[model samples]
Each structure stands twice: as C-alpha cells, then as structure tokens.
Target: MKKTRFHNKYKLIILGVIILLTGCFGLIYFFYRQSPARGEESGDMVAGVSAGALSNTSFIKTYHLRDTTHGYGLFPTKDGGYLVTGDTIAGGGMAAPYPYIVKTDAKGGKVWSRDFSSQSGALGYLSNRHLGRLAVETSDGSFVTASDVIDFVDENLKEIYGDVLLTKLNKNGAQLWSLMLGDHNIDRPRQIWALPNGEVMLLARFLKTGYSSEITDGIPEYSVFIKIDKNGKVQFSKKMEWNATGAERLVDGGFIVLANIAVILPKPAENIVGPEVVPHPLPTMIKLDSDLNIVWAKSMEMIPTEMNSPTSYAGGVMTVGKTIIREAGGDFRVIQAAPDGGFVAFGYDNLILTQGMSSGGAINISDKDVSLRPLVAVKVGANGNYQWAKKLTVNLVSGGSANDFHVVRTADGNFVIMKDVAHDALGVLAAASAVNIGLIKTDADLNPLWVKQYSVERSVEGYGLWPTVDKGVVVAGSMQTTKMHYVMGTSEPYTEAALIKVDVNGDVGGCAAVTTHTGATLEDQSSYLVMQDMKVMGSENLTLKINKKVKEKVNNAKSAARDICKYKKSNVTPIYSLLTSSDGSSPTASGQTVVPSTAKTWAVINYENAKEVAVVGEKNQVIHAELLPILNQVYNSQVKMKDSMASMWLAYVFPRPVTRADVEVIQKNLEGLGYKITGSEGGDLWVSKIGLTLHLEFAIQNSMMGKLEVRF
Candidate 1:
C-alpha cells in the first residue's frame, strides 16, 4: 500500500482469482496425463451457458456492479438491449462514479447509464479508478472513445491526453453530443474499430514530447492511427515512434498494428549495472492501412536497453511470476504483410536474467524489474518490405523460463496459445510458476497438432479477449488465485477480479456445444467475477451468495437457500444439462442426449471444477455426492476447471486390475478419511463418475489431437 506499482483490483487480485480470472480467461482447459474431475461451487448465476459448434444453449447476463473497467464495450444497440462500458472505481480517486456507460436489456436491467463530462470517482475522470482505451457505438446512437481522468492539476495526468472525449447517448442515458478530443498531447483512446463501411477505426496513443532527452516524447513513447466518421471527424493520424500495445480491426478493411516500434539503440558502451540487464530493441508490429496512408509496416527488431522493450501485451492465465519482464516471453511469428513491404519474423531469444531456487532457501535471481522469458514461436515469411528481423542462439539453461506465450487464433481456424507456464516440477519440488492456459491447436502448416494445458493459480500479466460469435473462446482476465465462485473470497493479496469461460475447441469451461457464440454469462462477485458474453447469449448461472460454506450448502439445499442466504446479497439458480454423442458430431454444453443403452447412463453436475468439495458435477447431485478425494484426481492436475461434466470410458471400465481390492478400499477410505496415503501401490481409481458421454469423450479427444472418436 505504500509502494506505487500496478495498483490493485484495477481494485483486487485474483484471491482464489474471481470464482476465477476476473480479466482474460480460458478456465476450461484439459491436459489428461491424469488427475482432474472436480466441480461444485454453486453460488448461482447461470441462465444459458453452452454454445457453438454443437454445444448450443444460451441466456445469461445478470450482475450489474462491483468493480469493472478493462475498457468495456460491445455493440448492437439501436435500442433492443446491450451496450455496456466499464470504469466505476467504487469510492476512490478521480471524481464520483464515472466511466460507467450502461444500456442493458437482453437482461442486465439498466437500460441507461452514463458518466463523462467529469465525475472521476465511481468510474470516470481516470487516475486510479479506471476506463480508457476506446469505447464506441456512435453512428448517432452516440458513444465515443477515451474516458477517465476527470481531475488533475498540472500536466493534466495524461489520460491518453484525457479527452478525445465524446458522449452522445439516447437509449436512455441521454446526452446527444459532448466533445473534447485533442488540445495538446495525451490522445490515449485505444481500439474501437467498426467499418462495415461506416468507417471509425481508431487505435490511438499519443503522449508526445520527444523520446527522452530525459523525460519528453511527451513521455508516453508513441503509437497512433485515427480515422473518424461517426461525427468526431479526424480522418487520419498515423504515427509510431515505437509504443503501442494493441490495435485490432482487420476483418480486412485494414488496421492491425499490435505495436512497439522504438528502437533508439546506442546506449551501452559499458556499465552493466547490477542484477544482469541487457535489452533495448523493442519494435514488434503488424501494420497495414489505407486512410492514414501506411499501406504496410512491420517492425520487430531486438538487441538494444532498459532491459527488453517490446513491452505490454499479455493474455489470460493471470501472470506476473517474474521471468525478468520484456513481456514475459515471445514466440510471435505472425505473417501476412507482403506487397513489397517485406516481413518474415521467426523470433525467439530472450531470457533476461535467470538464476533460480526458491521455497525459502534464498537465491531467487533478484528481479531486474520487467521480468523475462519470451522467444519460442519462430517460423517466419514476409514480403511487405523488411526490418523487423531476428536470429539468435545461445542458452545453457539454469532454471529454464523461456517460452513466453500468447498468440491466439483457434476455434477451428487453427492457432491457440496462452502460456505463462513453467515446467520441471519433478524433484524436491522447487521450480514453480504454474499459470498455464495453453490450448494449442495448430494447422495450415503451423504444425503442432494437439497440446492442451490449463493450470492457473496467478501471474497472468493482463488480458480480456472476446471472439466467440460461434467459433469458441470467450476469455476474460484478472486472477491471483481462483476456483471460480461468485462470492467466495480469498486472494486479498492483490485484491480481486476474475472471470473465465473457455469453449470453442479450447476444451470446456462454460457454454460450448456448438451454437458458436451463445450464452456467456459468468457474473460472480465478492470482490468480483464478471462475464456477460451476450454477442448472442443465454443461460442463467447468476449467483449472489457471499460465501460462508456456500451459505451452509444453501441451508442444506432448498428452503429458499436459508431465506436468500444473506452476506450482503444472495440468490443464485441457473443450471442446464446437454451432451451429445452417437453421431450428433460433438456437442456438450447441455445438448443432453443419450439412449444407446449399454446401460445408457449419462450424468453431469456443475461446480466450476478445480478441487472444491464439488469440483465437477451431476453424477448424482446429492450435491455431487459431497465430492472430495482430492476431488477425484485422474491424471492429477492439482486443479482448474469452470464447470465440468463428461462421459464414456468403459474400455471395460479401463484395464481393470488395480486389484488388491483396489488397494484395500483406497487404504481404508484414505485411512478413514485422514487422507495422506503417499502410495501403498496400486492406482487408477478416479470415479466421481462424469458423463454427457464423458463430456463428449473429453471434447472429441480435445478437438482432434487424438483424432476425434467419441462413441459411447
């Protein structure tokens, strides 16, 4: 509290992390060496989660507040319902309740909400509170970009220059037109692309001054790309001295410059500093435009200062385990910029300070600040021009820490990555950094056929992705630790905010049996766990309990959950069942099918997974048989899952013989429940009994890696 670093929550860390990942999540992952099958966290909040490819099901969107602002925005509202924006700082800095925005209706209530002119506090005016990074809906329904920072004395606090400011609501919040964009510097506003022809694209960043004659390029670095139309009018403004963390909007019209392009270089002649630091070549990009006039631009040069520059851009899994920073790690090799601009990146080569050993014994590498690891995704080919080049080799390996992952593109098209992973947990048990949300499924020559892993505890830099209209993958970030419960609190270490839901071949989390993108509503809260995925949704898993042994298991199930179970708030109920097999292709998010009869037994219970007395649900819901055996460890992944249910395994129940009376009835019921066996030999016995056809043969053998064969 006396330090001044990344702040907290935006407001809190992932105390168990959000019910999980308050930010960019993928809580539905699978690896299967063994050990997993835990569910049960019923705080309620589900209306219709289960969509696309075959997992068809929808309807979910109920939680209204608690702390939100990762730059929220999600279109479709001439008025029918839904516009949501973020930043509501609670009772803190800036002014009083700003960045808000609202407009709900498919069912979040509030058909009107606003803040911008400058209230600062609740969610506006910026400075601590939140919200800034573009938000749009304009074309008349009014809703422009750049908010937060409603107060400041001198240099104006620079909120992307605090105010390209524009507000013009109608569905109810009312305001018709309020402008203020560009007076001197700070035009921050990031990402807000929408040009089916209406043209709006604006991925801005301009703090301008110089670059550092000491503290001047205005002190923000550089990154700009504007093109207005919905009434603000800017037309063009393409700049890039090297400093843009993100920029999307390219279904094709143009605009995709995930930034960093400032390679000043030329500092060190000698002066190595203390704890090992050698970096200063930050310039990673993927530019392409037409209006601002940059037909193409692709930079990514390294080997230069201040310890690795291509900073910021992390995906879910909650990172910060400290790889030495430089954006944890990098293996980015995204190509497609060849018209004479030339681009062929195959990057990989970043360690930035290694040296390990922890668990109290000391000597933990110290930390040069930004952390490090990157460089593993190499394989380039470009022709737009040339400049962002790389090629290096030299590593002896002392504690490992390299593969800095996050290069998504999955749900069938191929390419899915998100790893803040750390392997080698074998010996006296030391090297730990377990936050891996990898669902790799490459093809089109991108190689890698199947690689799935999901073990998040904390340390995922920051992200909140969303691209599921019907392909799969609806990630949101924020975590410090989580088992996904909407009112179960704990990670008070950083604060709290986590939200997860992964399904679209990413392999199970919530909503995905094939409807593509329907019903994605996570909404948990104590500190926070929000999700609204209503691009086309439904399913009411909308909890409100505040945790107390889950209101003593809902005052023992029913009886109106102990009269609305108190704890500031409580009221949850929304459960569905669907599973497909026998040729329905591969549907699960509740398609609920069976009837082939070999005994045709299919069950499913939801608990958000992990190892909570209720890890993976519905095999016999006496609340899932009061689950617990380390939550039925199969293949043993310790934990991580959002709501589990699977089916089929009868290869004759599996090789059989673990005999010796199945290790004497699990060593006399885990020594009459004291549980600490260590191993009296004999294994294979994880039967919490999952179904929906073993969750569709574990999502079609994790979407094809095993070749796809699920027939119970």
Candidate 2:
C-alpha cells in the first residue's frame, strides 16, 4: 500500500514539470512572432535601433508625390545633392502623364518638387505619355532635362503627335526657360550633353515620313543633332541617316553617336518565297567632328553562328556553301566614354538560328529553345577601331530575362552594370510579374568581381545609377504597389519613385544568402568588325518657343498621397555570394569585412595599416554626450572618429560643398549651442566652448569637387 502511494506522488510531480516546460515554450514563440529577427523574412530591420543600426549614409526610401510616379533619371549636383526626373499621373481614368522633377539633399530628403505640366500652358493637354529620360547638371549649377512629350491626343485618348521638349531650371528650382522642337511628327530626344562653353548638345530620333506602325521594309527615321545655347537658342541642327540611340562627347570636343543600320545577309539566308530581302538591324558607331562632319563609322559584327556544343544548333547541320543568318533585331543601348580615351558600349546579342532549303525548296529555319541570352560589351579605340568584346550569360532562375541595363565606371577603375531582371508569376509561383534589380561589378578586363540581386519591391525597374565618393552606389528607379482606385472600384498597381543607397559591399543593414552565379566567360572577338566612312548631312538652325510658367505649391508631408498611393522602404538586402576572381574561382573569404567603428578610423586602418587603441577612461561616454547635440543640429552630415592613446576626436563631414554661406549657417547654429568662433584663418575657422574646441576646414579637391571637414 505504501509503494502505491509513492508512485502516485512521483507521477504528479512529473505531470507538473511537463506543464511548466510547455508554458515556457509557448511564451517564447509568442514573443518571437511579435518581433522576429532581422533577415528572417524580408531582411529589413527597423531603423534607429541601438544594437545594430545602419550607417547614417545608407538608406532605401520611396517617394510618392502623386497617384502614380516613375523615376527615369538621376544626376548628382555639384552641391552634393541629386536631381530626379520622371513623370507623374493623376488618380483618374485615362489621365495623362506630366513631366515631374524633384531635387533632394544628400540624405534623400526632398528639397523642392516641380510638375512642368501644371506650370506650362503648352503641356496642358490630355496625352498618353510624357517621358523624361535624361537630366544633367550644368557648369553654372543649373539643371536641364530632355523629355518626349506627346502633346496631341485623339478622341479615343490615343497619342497622335510627339515633340522633344527641353527645360532648364536654376539651382533653386526656378524655371529659367523651356523649348519645344517638332516637325509635326514623332521627335524623341535620345541624349543631352553639357559642353564646357555653356552650351548643350541634344541627340534625337526624328520620324521623317510614314507612320511607325506602317513601316515594314525599313524604319523611316533620322538622327538629329542640335546644338543649343544657354539662352534656349538653337545654334545648329544636323541630321544623319539612321536612328541614334546614344551619344558621348569626346575629350577633343568631338562626339560619337551610336545608331542602327539595316544590313542584308548573303546567300542561303534569303527567303525562298519572294524577291524581297529582310534587312537585319545592326548597331553602328559614327564619329563626328566639331563642325558636325562625319569622321568614321564602324558596325558591330554579329555573334558567330558556330557553337562547340551540339545541342545549341538543335541537332541541325549546316549544308555545304551555306551560312547561318544573323537575327533580325539587335542594338547597343548605352555608350560610355572610357578612361583610355575610347568608348565602351553595352547591349544584347540576337538569338542564333540557321536557315536552309527543305526538300521542297522552301525556307526552313531551325531554332533552339534557349533559356539564356548573352549580354555583350564592346570597347573601341578613339579612332573607332574595335578593341575587345566580352559576353556574359546570366541564368535566370525566375524564368525571366534581362530588360534594361546601365553601365558606369567607378572611381576605382572598375565597371558596374545595373540590369533589370523580370520575374513572372508562372515561374516564381507569385501573384504577378515582378522585376528585380541586378548589379554586377567587373574588373578593367570585363571579368566579373561580384554579382548581386536586390528585390526592392514586388515590381521595380532601375533606370539610373551613380557612383558615390565613398565607393558605394546609388540606384534610382520606380517601385510598384497596389492601390484601390475609387472610380474603377478595383485595386490597381501604383508606382512610386525609389532611391537606394548602399555601402561599398552592397549591403543595406541586413542581408540574406541566395544563389550565386559563376564568373562571366570572356572571348576575344576584336577582329570580326571593320570601320568605314559614312555620310553626314548639312546643319541648320530650328526655331524654339518659350512656354509659360506657373509656380505650384510644394507638398512636404509624407502622408500627402496616402489615399491614392503607397510608399515602401526596401525590406530585402542584396546578397553578394557571387564574388569571384579573374580565373573564375570563388574566393576563400567572404566579400564583407568588418569596418572600424568610425569612418576616419577605417580609413586609417586601411590606408595606413594602423593598430587600434582602446579608450582609457569614460572618455567615449563624455564625447558622445558632447557630440550628440552638434550631430543632431547637422543631422544630414556624416561623423567619423579619430581615436588615439591620448584622446579621441570627432570629425564631421558636410553633405554639400562648403561655401561661405554654409559656414555662416553652421557658425550660427553652433553659437546657439553655446559655442563661439574664437579665430579664423584662410578657409579655416576655430570655435570654442567651455571645455571643447572645434575646427572647420574647407578643402577643394578640384575645380568641380569640394568638401568640408569639421573636427572637435
């Protein structure tokens, strides 16, 4: 009887212990659901966390000033700010798009916003699209934008006619002048360059005759180059044969234009049915003299038709004396001036296929189901001779392909390419199609250094990229969000302008691991193409009209467009697992390295290889207390620290180039905080308080770049 009683007591004790353990796990899971860890889902952590906060310079933000907004171009200003050009549409049925521009400070804070359609009387019409693809800052600190505005619309809300519009604004966002050029046809601006003589050069695609849809044999297009003065006067206008896509100003005051020409292939590629010959579009580069005369022209060759792998040709064999035909469409999209006085062009190659005659003498073309496409990069010398070509093949796991791409050379002599990859719901098992931005950094030889993919939103398209002084990059684009349309009584996708600033490692606070791509294969195909001379037409001056301007009230509220639009910060950080060497081997170490506590310390450690010194007393706490107030006043600036065995000093880096006006403002702000200027020297000022001393120094790197450094 006593043994039975003891057994019952032990069973009760075990039951109580199990219940306690179960309750503890339940509470732990409940708290985890409330506040999950970073990089668990979207890889986003809330800002301002003291434990693992991001650097003050890194940010990912979306701005919605209207119902729908799209960012097309981004340019850095001399004042360390940025200018964004895009279009915005109202929240109504069949609303027309208006050219929009926004200027922001270095920290991505909006300074001023303008909608040209609301200001100009010429733009007060319902149209289909108004696309502003390029903007640049002039030597005088003014801004200029080139846009294609469809001003005429039919009764069915269809676009009828389009014109090229050039608008200039002062540094304060005030309109200086506006001009429109058209010939009663579609005239789209392709590129604009600011000259050193306060003049601007514009390249446009002009439809000379015939409707774009009705042209079947050849595209009835002409390349128009116009030189305009600062006062909005057209100095000269030159016309060329084909449609121009890109242009770059040579160092010797000349220019190089990238255009497309029709080329007819030889022999068995001809159609067997008719006497008509299909002309394939080929990219050609034309160099122009300062007087608008053609110097030389070079056409890029097609990718070779032969492949080492048998499956690439779909098991078909080439007949004797028969050659494979090049694809019908291929064009270079971007042309950038290289450091070696030459130019680098980037584009995609056409798909491969072979044409032959069947047993019945009919045309038979065998094509393979290619899931990958090669992105081509070509380099040419200053004399317009081909230097080298590299091909990159990207395997899209989302079953999509690359869309738009931009390439820029970094300060470190590397090239960074930003490309958009489209993702379909059928392949990704999502609700809709989306686009993710991909960044690939390559060495001087076009070998891949690293590749990363960033999904900022469900659908995002990057159109502009600029490298920063800190070796990082900023990407500006448009992201889509779902919004309820009151009139349509349904939800529709809305667009907002997105700007992302990442560190040198392409990190945005938190990142997750993803699949990596091998290095891009490089092949030397420089001997395939030859340069020839092309014809250049005469130059003429065209008339320009000034449009009326009306100032609109700037809205600064973040929730102003809440009802009609949505803004989203990026939740996912890009992965950098694809870092590789020139020999296509993975690196043993990860691409990321732990940076020092401050920027000055990091620079010292990297450049000087200095050892770290620990703080002796409560000096760090005292320094933080004294510096927090000053930092709060100049919250937009970046702060770095210099630590030594004796003392620690804080350095404040101004966001904009330092001017007398900026210095005076800082002095006033500091004086309000109990600091007084004690002495002054050439481009240097000293301020002091009861126990603190501050030094302000203005240094100029070049005629165009300057910086302000503050030490205390």
Candidate 3:
C-alpha cells in the first residue's frame, strides 16, 4: 500500500510538470499575436505572391499620302474619334494642292478622308493652294472648317491672291455648303467657332491700308470678325484695327480676340533715307459683345529693353539709347477659356531687332542680332482686368523661331503648352541640330510641373494639341522622313502627319528612358491698348466639293526610327486574380463561415479601418498557416489570422502608427523573397508572385492598421 501511494504521488508530479509546460506555450503564442511586428523581416512568407500580365492602348501613328501632307488641327469627336485638317498634295503631284480632312478612330485608324480640290474646281482654278487649317464639330453632329483658297493664279500656276473659305460638311463626309470671303486681296481665316444656335463665327486677317496714313509704306493687315448663319449667309461683319492671332467665343455670348497691334515708332532724326516709322508688334486682348461690339482692350506693356546698338526705341518712345532702331516683335498665338469665366493667352515675347549705322552711313543688322525671350502666359479676369502673367523659360535656339506654339487647358484646371525646341533644351543627348516637340505641364497659376520632349531621327513640328479623357494628351504634327524622289535626283526628306499619345506621366511604352526638364517661371507685366471698330461686307456663296480619298498608314512600330519615338504602355494598375475556392467547392458551402455578401474585397485605402473584418479561405488557410509560424519566428511575436469562405484577409494592428520606413521594410522583405512589386501608390503596395497577389494597405493614421489581402 505504501508503494502504490508513492506511485500516485509520482503521477501527480508528472501532471503538474505537463500543465506548467502547456501554460508556457499558450503564453508565448498570446504575446506573439499581440505584439506589433512592424519592420520585421517577412522571410519566405511572400515568396509565392504573383500577379497577371498587364495591357495598354497607347500608339504612335503616321498617315502617308501620295505627296506632302501637313497636320494643322486635331479635335476629339463625340464618338471617341479624332478629326485632322491640313493641306495635302493630291495625285502624287504639287498641281493638286487641296485642303484635306481625315477622320480617325480612337486607335488612330483612318476612317475616311476628304479633299476640296474637286469643289475648288468650280472657281475655274485647276491649280491652286488650298489649306484647311482649323475645323470644329457643331452640336448638330456636323463639321465646319475654315480654310484659305488661292483665288487668282499667275501664268506659272503661282498663287497671286487668297480668299477665306468656310465649308460645312455632314457627319458622313458630304459637303453641305460653302462660302467665300475676300476683298480681291489676301484674306486668310485664322480661327473659327461654332455657335450654339447653328451659326458660326470666323476671324480672318484682311490686307488693308497701313496703320498710319502719313507714313504709308507697308501694307497693314486688319482682323474681321464675321458671323454667318447655317445656310451660308452672313449675319454680321465687324472689322478691327489689329490683326487677330487668336480668338474664342465666351460662354455669355461674347468674344475674346488676341491680336497684335503695330505701334508705329518714329524714326530717329539721324536716319534720313530709312522709313519714317518702324512697326513694333504688341500683344493686345479685346473683349466684344455678341454683336461684335468692343467692350475693353488691354495690351501687354512693353518689356524693359536694353539698347544693344546706339539707338533704342520702344512703344513709340525713345529711351536713353542711341539710334539703336529697336523693333519689338511678338504675338499671342493661342487663347483658351478659363475655369473662372476668365481667359488665358499664351505667346512668346521680347523679339527685338537693333539696327546701327556705320560711319559710312550703311545699315549693319543681321539675323544674329535678334534677341528672343522666353514664352509667356497671361491671365485676365472676366472684366478684362489683368490677373497674372508668367514667363515660361525654355532653352531656345539662337536664330530659330518658336512661332508654332499651342496651348490647351486640361479638365483638371491645369494648362499644357506644346512647342518646338532643340533636343538639348530638354536635356536629351542628340545632334546639335536635332529638334523635338516639347510638352510643358503647368498648374492653374502657370507653374510648370514637368517638361518632356518627344522626337525621332529627324525633326518634329507639333501644330495641334488636345487633352484626352484619361487626363493625358494627344499631339498631332508632322515628322520628317528621308525617301527616294525620282524628280529630285536624290533621296530627300519629306513630312508626314504624325500622331503621338501619352499618359499623364509622359511615359511611353517600350521606351524606358525619358528625358525630363525642370522649367522655371517668372512674373510678367502688361498694360492696355486702344481699340477701334470698323465695318465689312458679307461674302458670296460658292460651290465646293469634298471628294473622298484614301491615305496610307505608316506603321510607326515597324519604322526604323521607332526606337526614337515611343508610345505609352498601360497607365492603370491591374488587378491580378479573383477570389475562388481552392477545393473547387461552392463558395456558399454548408458549415462554411463566409464573409458578408455585400463586402468589397478591393476597397479604397482610407484612413479609417475596415468596418467588417475579412475571413480566410481554404487556399489562404494553407498560406496563413505557413506564414504565421514563420512571421512568429522572425518577429518574435505571435501572428494571428482570420478565416472565411470567400477569401483570405489578415489585419495586423500595430502598437504605434505605421510609418513609411516600416512599410519599406516589409516591401523589401517581400521583394527579397521573390515577390515582385507590381505597383505602389500613396500608402498602398501590390506584391505578386506565381498565382498569388498580396495587397498591403498601410493606414498611417488612426489605428495605424496594416491589412494584407491574399487572393488567388
């Protein structure tokens, strides 16, 4: 009996020892799951994370015709297509210069093309230069274009005079009617606007008398604003003293005109043979009512001028400088309606020419003596009051001109300026003579966010720019190419219409490297200008035909210079896989605890923690079971996981707020374990490998919770 009691005591001792060890392990797991494991190495836990492939729809396309073709205007249609207008030589010859219009689908595939050569033949001209520079789609689903048609030709088929032509076309590329406006001289339409009431407004430059009657030397050009009905009848014709460079219709049935007025500066007394007056072009803004009545006129003040020669003159006034015959030349090329019912004008300024006379009474001036300034953007309020002006500093070539600058306001209240610049200007290493199209993105206040240059082997001249629905931009222009020309005896470079589409980041697919530039801005100044109104007559209806034609598509991707000009890849972060049951069973299997049916797996990563936690699925359970022990060992803390029927989602609560560094540590650990970082934005990161995707959402505020979602 004593021996049996001793054995029971030994059994009790052994039971006490087993209980103590069980309590120790439970305590270890409890502390491991409770402690935050941020910044701890994830080791092999993320090795199997993976994602699916991604796709994009960016492209670079060039349209080829029989002869030379130029792209002048590009507009997005309501059907997600594009309309391009310019001049093209027909029948592979220069004798058939016609105003050309081509429509393309969203992917830059040519849908249809039309030329005005057949219609212009009604004017009894077989060989004339017709240029369709601008076109806009009306609310009635029709299209209208403003062009310049050579009216008179010499014996050698040379253009003698030009007339403004307005042609309206149906949606199917059929011409409805045409109108011609001219004064038996040079009349070129600069801009056109479609009215809400089925009417159209046109701004044209008319060659007229000189600005000054006393010193009548050079023929001065004036701007004419004409409103015409849908039936090709003129409604109102109002003429202005200045030449309109840009114009747009306002929302309140008003109009804003950006023009340049030639301020005549008196010639110095020392010059007896030269002209009596020097014409200096100044940028002016004019506001007019719907009836074409001028409301207010403001001009950019003459920038401070430094005399390079002996004489300097500006704003018709001579400064403390010698006969440096200073001639300021610049004009605002484009304007757009602002968000606040205002207007923004963009142009280049400070183009000065200084002329000095030698002791032998000979003029000494060359093109090299010209001084060019950076591009400028000016903003004005609805009341015609000057708000702000900014100078866009760019590295411009010494003798090169940047007259073909275009600007378009984005949907986000920002502005984008497209201009031609040397490759070096954009920090691109290329030939000294290489030129590229530069795009500058600016904020609402004209502060440049970034600058990018697009180029090929030859030069690129961008003429049209339009913002895309994806907050990107579509640029249409001409690119030069060297081809064999039998008539030229040697291979010569010709231009073809080119279209390039890029995303907001200015990144092109297949081209990993992009040259970026840091653009600077400066405060600018402006003043006011005097305005005068005049009257003009209407035009006669003309017969014109828009003949359907076909244009060849040059595969930019197969071109030899394809490596130089790249297209955009995918701009969106792709989601890899969807949730599914690993055992191929129904998601609503009996006895399975499933998440709420209305729960969204991919929710926006806000600061607030998820209201309902997610449960782990069968596939995630395996990974969860393997990951917890590994994480527990690495972090010296216990890791816990939730289970569900739909998918696997693990929420890790940190004792302190999550930090960028902590997130970086976790990302690095996953990358080291063979997981690829597919994308990262803000505080969220996506990691994938094989068939698994791990979306790590780190909330840096509030509870500072980090949620890791596993999907297969």
Please give the lDDT score for candidate 1. Answer: 0.32
Candidate number with greatest TM-score: 2
Cα lDDT of model 1 by residue, 587-688, tens digit: 222112211111100111011111232233234243223222423432132222323333321111111112344345534654454434333432322222
Off by over 4 Å in 1: 1-102, 106-163, 168-171, 183-186, 190-204, 207-277, 281-712
TM-score of 2: 0.59
**What TM-score fits each model?**
0.22, 0.59, 0.56
Write one digit per residue (lDDT tens) for candidate 3, span 602-629.
1111212223435455776665664555
Clashes in predicted model 1: 166
How many clashes show up per model? 166, 0, 19
Q: Would you list the clashing residue pairs of candidate 2?
A: none
